[model samples]
Target chain A: MINSRDILETIRMIQDENLDIRTITMGISLLDCCCDDIDRSCQKIYDKITTKAARLVAVGNEIEKEYGVPIINKRIAVTPIAMLLASSGGDPVKYALTLERAAREVGVNFIGGYSALVQKGFAPGDEQLIRSIPEALAKTQHVCSSVNIGSTKTGINMDAVAMMGDIVKEAAELTKDDNCIGAAKLVVFCNAPEDNPFMAGAFHGPGEPECVINVGVSGPGVVRSALKKIPDGNLTDVADVIKKTAFKITRLGQLIASEASRRLDVPFGIVDLSLAPTPAVGDSVAHILEEIGLETCGAHGTTAALALLNDAVKKGGTMASSHVGGLSGAFIPVSEDAGMIDAAREGILKIEKLEAMTAVCSVGLDMIVVPGSTTSEVISAIIADEAAIGMVNSKTTAVRLIPAIGKDVGDELNFGGLLGAGPVMSINTASPAKMIARGGRIPAPLQSLKN
Target chain B: MRAVITVIGRDVVGILAEVSGKCSELNVNIAEVTQSVLQDMFCMIMLVDMDKCSIPLADFSDIMKKLGEKHGLSIHVMHGDVFDSMYHV
Candidate 1:
């Protein structure tokens, strides 16, 4: 029994509030596509994805019209190419190239699963894929790469964690044009959710259905507005007010996703109820913190405060939707979250503090801005540090640091709205590049080997 | 005597206020109530002390049934002991 007004407001959210089916990610397992011959496997991989995903865009568009909801991104996630390569004898770079070609042909914005789960440790093809990440991602526009270097169960695999520090630099150097956008597509995770439909973390799990639809709902603006209206500022009231507002917002997501799935004839994935902050002015996790009485975001009690916010959002969101997944927590991208930008400008938040906060949320250190002159090796070290956090905790984490050219510490570079602005944050003078520059695929963690 | 009322449908205008108003007129004291919207559909459960009510259970339940059907909702009336045994206890 939907109300006409609630229906109208839902429609308005789609038409204006940047609300869209964040991703219509089709997960295709490549197990059936595998063969001893590499080319045959590639052909099977290509055919399976393109054929299965052919109706993806049309279906998304139809739903947008019928329900007046917008579906923004259409994507595909294949079984890890590394595993496919184990039986199909081919060069890693060439295999990645085939994946990129298939993605372009399928017309999906991004195709994930150029990944390896090294949490416990890497398997056979993991080495080849990790080694070829820079070349593979650089060679193809549609391919997104992610590596799960740590998980809560196995703890952080420091050796593999050590190597990824350098891989990021190579990736950034390869895609220099999109403001080091290659690094933007890479994610490092702890307990990476198997059903995450968002890229660059999306990958078809061995256990997933061949094709499915998942909706990642983000509305930091809604939360911010609620926070802004609290006239009297008590920390207890702030938390209570946020909890109630989040309950309503998450309910909206659950309804929209359930309705969308019913109409599209696809099983609705999780209502990712993540408070994913954008560069939009009021729609930031950091801003919410500031509104909760922080003069600046990265102040002394920042991590504790953020942890509370992150946990509360999850608690309320889970109650709203049973099928919740995909980094269902607040996102604190430094460059993309406005509150983060101000904190960096005020010299309160730093890379180290953001790393500290990831222990409680899904996405790790994100949207940070480092000095452009900083070497890629150090950037890799940052990736490594963040990766370790994800691995030890078994949570999905990522790094989206921007190396703004000609900008030094304390200098602010604004990406403008939903990708807000970030101050050029200083890096540790004691560099890790020399250590990261060592280019071998670090041996798979010993714990990964089993009977 | 007691009666449990349940409303199952989508949330809309005046459902709670109007239904509660009827209960007030009948002198039925609401002991407990809770509601939630599940995937666009609303479900509510309410317990009332019908012993204090002026109207008979049949009359009060009749009013709820008429109002609910008018607004495209389904209404259910149950005895207090049955309602408590099934839901409360």
Candidate 2:
């Protein structure tokens, strides 16, 4: 049996290792809010949110107080607004603004639903929603966005794919000074989930109930610390140990979610059994990848190893929680995950290799640090490239690059705890700036219309 | 007309501050609270004191709605009697 102190130690690893739950998103269906009248529709959306999300942040805190475990984000996911308000016929931007206003009114940091589903083909509202990406994200302080351009089951939605390529570029242009921050607010997905609690990635699936609570489990440090105990452990045995550990870890999440739902009176939502990696030194998804056998972070076998690791953890967590969903895999965020930093220092991981890894697992390039000296055009180019992968492959992908204020390649800067330390990785410096400065929206690619 | 305040949101500034402010304004005492996040979403739970409160449940709910929207949130307030039976029972 895992000792009680071991549990406390797990909790401590999260604290000392800069680990915490990445998200605790409540899923609320907005189907009932659908209507032709803008005001009436707004009213329904507002009522549904306030009625269902009133105590969300508060209850989440109470649990934190008792367990001494921190929840980093308290958020909500509603039905894709496109599905609900597309029939407004024209100018979905205004409705999106209304949704943005309501999200502010309710007090959640980000409200995700400026979304569309073109996996098979574009829905009328999806086109409108896609067009609203740059404007909606730019105008609103807290409205995150996503587009499901494809899915594994559906293969890929070519048209949706093509459009998103341009959309990401547009969003990057809209928020160029903010680190091309708009791209951070959106994701392109394949086999998009209905009840992912993390965003700009989360959305209420059509199959979900009116309202439910979804939990995202994290503590890369806890897993990392556990690994330290068994240094040089056999790879096969590591899988068994990881499964048992994940079972207990996910059970704790299940308990917390169940208790929260029972106390709050909402139906219990699923547990997002994802080992969300953070910038903290001890809690790194890349560390797990390396421990599973890799000479460096961006080694040749990275993706195959990550896919296997994701599958094993899911098998373990599935046994732990019946209600599991969301992006339940190892998050390989370079700046935010500690192990990647070590690999970068060791000259083992490279930017291109990380890109290849994204083809398989982890939320696409996240918390990556590039030099401030790099031009905005290059940043936009990077965004376009990453989005292209997500769009064509039809999987959820995002980018959060920090253009370090005065940093250079081969130099390291520490963000201090949980945010993780980073090495400003080298970016191609051949002045792709000229190409990016040309800056017109990349037209929707021809591959976008498979459906 | 007892109610339960379940707060699920992120670890951001004033999540605790704003909710507590509302509870006190409504003359609702904080019976219990659990502020924590899971799955990248934050949440909390508070048992309100409606015994001597002058406001109606609907009014309290509206005040909550206004405050919640001002901050970009999704809030849900349930009657304690109803909440307990629905969830606990």
Candidate 3:
């Protein structure tokens, strides 16, 4: 027997509160697809991905219908393409094109893992792949790229950091005609997770299984609505409300992950208990913060508020799923959240404030647009600052800044749907050219010496 | 297998009969049903056994959705396991 109350609550959460499975990413390892010839490797990679993920979209649709939960994206992640590039040793764009073909063939929204892991230092194929990101992303429609340039165990790779600045800028410039969508598809990371299922940053790390299903759950609106019932609750009461809401959200994710894994016959990976927000009016994470009694999302106590929210979500979610990995925390992508966008447009939310917020949340400086004149060195410096935070705290942080070419402060680029639209926010123009020119790895902190 | 069907809309006569008629046509047994009328809005929750259902749950869900649309109601059909897994340990 099922309780009518629980049934109605579930329905309300889905229909009214905008609760959803953010993504069901199928991680397919392409190491076995590697070959000496680039073309041959591309073919093998395409064949493997298409064959493995052929039923992903169909299964996702079936589950969405049967469970009555919206699964927004059916995506695929592959082992970092740099490994395959090392063996194949040809123009890296070949792999990107092949990935695009496979994604379209299998009818997936996006295919990630056109990526490299140079957290320690660049390897044989790393620099080539890194340099080609701009062209590759500009050429392909659904391929996402990421580069791990720092880690807690092995300090920051300044060389890769510096190069990534130019890469990020070029990625945007190449696709400037299309709202700089290229740069939005690239992420530069520190302490990057091997099994994150979210896109623009998701890549099947080399450490992941041959093939697996990872799920990301989303419900900022549900959390906010839950908090709304207790308007005068103390901070203690607030955390409890958030934790309870997170528990319900994650249980649904665990159920969906298990079901998807069973249907696909792939190993179940993990449930990413993330409070990811969409541009929908009611689905903003910043609204949850406001519901927590903040004046605005980027106010003085914003960091403290985000810290509490992030911790409570983890505390509640850890017990709901058997395995919870990925960047499982509150996401505050500015353009993707309506509240954050409003804050940014009003100048209440600045880049520096967002940087501070990232230290307390899951990701770092995501989906921000800077002026066209913002130099590559400045972009590299921003990456360095974010990487330092992730390195010291032993957490994952990433930068997905779009240098909106020919755009300036107060201008806006509308990418629309999911990627959303971003106002061109102002950034400090002080040149970091001297510091960026001094490219060297920043040593790992004492936190890494635990052993 | 069992599913939960929820219909929410304005209160109207024959709302229950129309839904149950479709369920019976599909060989689905209505194990339990609960309904509430707040002012003019009506909401119903039905626990249905689909062990001997003639059509797939997905198809039945679509059919019910269309039926609800015809009457300006919102209907949802979900597996009982979804509720069980979420509400229970």
- Per-residue CA lDDT of model 1 for A1-451, tens digit only, reads 2232333333334334444445667677888988898888888887887787777766666544433344567788877787887777677777677778878886778889888777666687787788788788778877888887666556655556666756776676676664566666677676677778777788877777766666676766666666777858676777776676566566655655665566556677777777776665556777777767778888878888888888778776677676887778887777777677777777888777877888776688776767777776677677667766665454677776666655678666654434456777888868876666664443334444543
Ranking according to lDDT, highest score first:
3, 1, 2
In DockQ terms, which candidate is top? 3
lDDT of candidate model 1 versus the reference: 0.69
Model 3's CAPRI class?
high
Better model by DockQ: candidate 1 vs candidate 2: 2
TM-score of each: 0.73, 0.70, 0.99
lDDT of each residue in A82-104, candidate 3, tens digit only: 99999899999999999999999
- Supply the TM-score of chain A against the true chain A for every candidate structure: 0.85, 0.80, 0.99
The number of the candidate with the highest lDDT is 3
Model 2: how far is A278 from its true place, Å?
Answer: 1.7
Worst 10 residues of 1 chain A by lDDT: A1-10
lDDT, candidate 2, A344-367, per-residue tens? 777678777877777676467776
Candidate 1 scores a chain A TM-score of 0.85
TM-score for candidate 1, residues paired by index: 0.73
**Candidate 2 residue A305 C-alpha distance from true site, Å:** 3.8
